[model samples]
Target chain A: MVLIYIDHSEKEIKKSSHEAISYGAAIAKQLGCSAEALLLGTVNDDLTTLGKLGASKVHQLNNESLNNFDAKVHASLIATTASNLNAEVIVFAHNINGKAIAPSVAVKLDAGIVTGACSLPSLQNGFEVTKTVFSGKAFASIKIETPKKVIAINQNSFGIQNYDSSATIEEMNLPIPTASVKVTNVNKIIGEIPLTEANLVVSGGRGLKGPENWGILLDLAKALGAATACSRPVSDSDWRPHHEHVGQTGIQIAPNLYIAIGISGAIQHLAGVNRSKTIVVINKDPEAPFFKAADYGVVGDAFEVVPAFTAAILKMKHNE
Target chain B: MNILVCISKTPDTTAKIAFTEGNTKFDENGVQWIINPYDEWYSLVRAIEIKEKDPTTNIHLITVGGPEAEPIIRKALALGGDEAIRVNSNSNDSYVIAQQIAAIAKQGAYDLIMTGKETIDYNSACIGSMLSAILDLPYVSLANHLEVNGNTATIQREIEGGEETNEVILPMIISCQKGMAEQRIPNMRGIMAARTKPLKVVDPVATNAHTSIKEFSLPPAKTGVKLIAPDQMEELVKLLKEEAKVI
Candidate 1:
């Protein structure tokens, strides 16, 4: 059996979870085994629909304590589930929650683990998986010699491919671990598209001058129906919130389109958005490093260029 | 309060990455090594910040590497660590490295053990989480704010599009990131004191590494930038619509 852990937030299933299920199911098909999904906490989305996306069965642990992410607790829960199902492979999306718990689970199960996996394992001769390393500057293919394995799929790597099947939901009464970390408060951005899930992202840096001039970036984002982010320096300087920061140490996103405005592309910054399918850079300095990574480069001041770009996008949308 | 901070010696952020010896090893000919930025700026700094609040608090540093890593360990000591320990193993396996750390952390009975989210070189982001499980301690990752009061630690960790604050007891392990603490530059006093600080060498615990690196390959380089004239906003929009279709 192949088990995929489905992660959710605020009762809603995250987009990455869907991608993981698809990736896991593809692996299951290759190994000629059944793919199943495991959910720790209660989620609002239809578990049956998740089957159509990937898994043949959905096992949910309807425990409230499992809602708040404690790596220790999650790892323990996942390790138990994998064992009970006699799972040969376990999969997780390499998001915040996955990154925190996958290693722990791997240790508990004595499984050979690969995080940030970009492709499915080659089961022809042996289990060989490719993963991103060196902060996305390189790729390393690893062969899992262990009998059981765990893989954390990177976002946007394997997309969701639908299957014409409905999953049977099963409730498991398992012993949930005691939570040591108590969530005191949750400060969440209510409505906008999350940076992790957004297909297109509009990010800025200190090059925009100050926080007061952020309206142009927002306008472009709104016009394009994209999420917004900022470079680490922008967040460090209090020009934007830390949640908006994306870099080697910040949120790693692999959107289809990433628009960087006024951001000089440092290698660390590139690590975060380098996986983006299409990068568009807008900066005044012709020698800015970001352009080298961008698919499209606009060499002009962000102040003059961003507004004009936003206007043209709005015009195109209006015409559409 | 006794805090144990784990740091890694990595190539400087701007160092050119190259492979050597049949692409099996990293070329270190001209690379300048430094303490991983996240370790220096966040993990070690936050522990030092806790120590600064109470003089009784002691901060110790540890890294799993050889003599070449001693200088990086000294850098952490100069930043506010009381002592340093270098595990005598240059293992690239995160699991083996975590075992070494868990062994030291277990013996020390540290109230808090912290490390960066991941090392820049390997970028495994696994040591702290694996160590937490091995030590049977509560663990938090990507912590932006951490404040310890008595036996409880209030930590605010970064979440998707927001933040979540959690309170965990002492003897917890954390993988820290930015916003935890400001960068502290080592002053002359720190540099002088760090040289005389107790630097201990310890043997690594015997454990099998689950993973081994095979080879190194760089990402495909960008071909060429398609520069669009700044004034031609219409042309740019048309290109995006027709060619890129991103908008």
Candidate 2:
């Protein structure tokens, strides 16, 4: 059996979790096993809706304590659930929660685990999975020697498919462990699209000069219904909050449309946003490294180009 | 205060990535190695910061690699680590590395353990969390700031839209990131002093690697960019809407 961990935050199921389900389902099809899902806490999303994403069965741990993410508890409980099902493969979205918990789960089950996996396992002779490495500069195929395997699929790597199968939700009665660290607060920046969930992202860098000049980027983001992000240097210089930074050492995001405005793509910066489906780089310097990775490039001053781009998007939205 | 810092040796950011032997092994012939940026800039620096605040604090650097990784570890020591430990092994498997780290950390009884959020090489990001599990200690990943007072530690980590401040008791693990501390360059004095720092090389306790490499390949090189003039912004929007379907 293939077990997928359904990621959730604040009562809503995450978008990347659905992509993981599809990836797991495809793997299950290859391995001739059943694809199932395990969800912690109760989510507002209808459990049966998971069938569209290819989950045949959904096992939910409905305890209130499981609502808030505690990696230790989540890993232990998820490992137990996977063991209970005798799952040959456990899949997770290589997002915040999955990256935290998957390794612990792997250690518990003594399973060979792969994170940032970009493809399905080749099961002809043995279980070999391909994963991104060297900060997305390369890919390596790794064989899982262990019978059980855990895979954390990178977001946007696998497209979700509608399988048209009904999924039955079952409640599990596993003992929940006490959280190790207490969460003093969960402070969310209200009324902004979250970078993780945003399919469209508009990010800026130091080239914007100062925080005072952020209006153009925000306007572009607002016009596009996209989340805003910044390069690590901008965050380091306090031009943007640390949470807004997206890079190798920051929040790794894989939005569908990543509009990088005035941001020269450092390797660390590219590592985070390289997974996006379509990258749009607008920088004054034509030699900026980001243009090479972008599907579309516009070399111009942000002061001139941003307003025009934002106005164009607003006009298009108005036409719709 | 005893703090253990974990380090990883990775190819420099500008190193040319290549594969060899029908893609079975990485072509390391021309690659230049350095301390993984996050380890140097965040993990080790943060440990140094804590040690500077309280002069009695001891910061030890540890790396799970062969002798080739010693230079990186020594570099870390020069940056402010009191000493260094090199576990004699070269396994890319994260679980095996974590087991070794857990065993060593248990024996040391360090008050805090730190490592980069993820190495720039494999980017598995599971070692620190796995170490926390094996040792049954609390862990904070991608932490921007950390403060310790006696047995209590207050950590601030980035969440989806904002940050969360968590309070945990000591003997915890933190996978450090950018904001933990600024990167420090080793001064001439420190570099000279590092030659005298203790670097104990030890054999790893027997561990099994659960994964093996089948092959390696570089990602397809990026195609040249499609340039669009600033006046053509409307065309770009049209393309995104009708062609890319992302607008």
lDDT tens readout by residue for model 1, A1-320: 89999999989888999999999999999999999999998878989998788799999999877888888888988999899889999999998889899999888888878888999987675888888877888888777777889899998989889899999999999877778889999998887888988999999998998999999999999989999999988998889987788998777789989999999999989988999988999999999999999999999988999999999988888898
Worst 10 residues of 1 chain A by lDDT: A137-146
User: Who wins the DockQ comparison?
Assistant: 2
> What lDDT score is found at residue A215 in candidate 2?
97
The DockQ values of the predictions, listed in order, are 0.71, 0.72
TM-score of chain B of 1: 0.97
If you assessed candidate 1 against the hidden native complex, which CAPRI class would it receive? Answer: medium
Interface C-alpha RMSD, model 2: 1.6
Q: After superposition, how far is residue B140 of candidate 2 from its true place, in Å?
A: 2.1
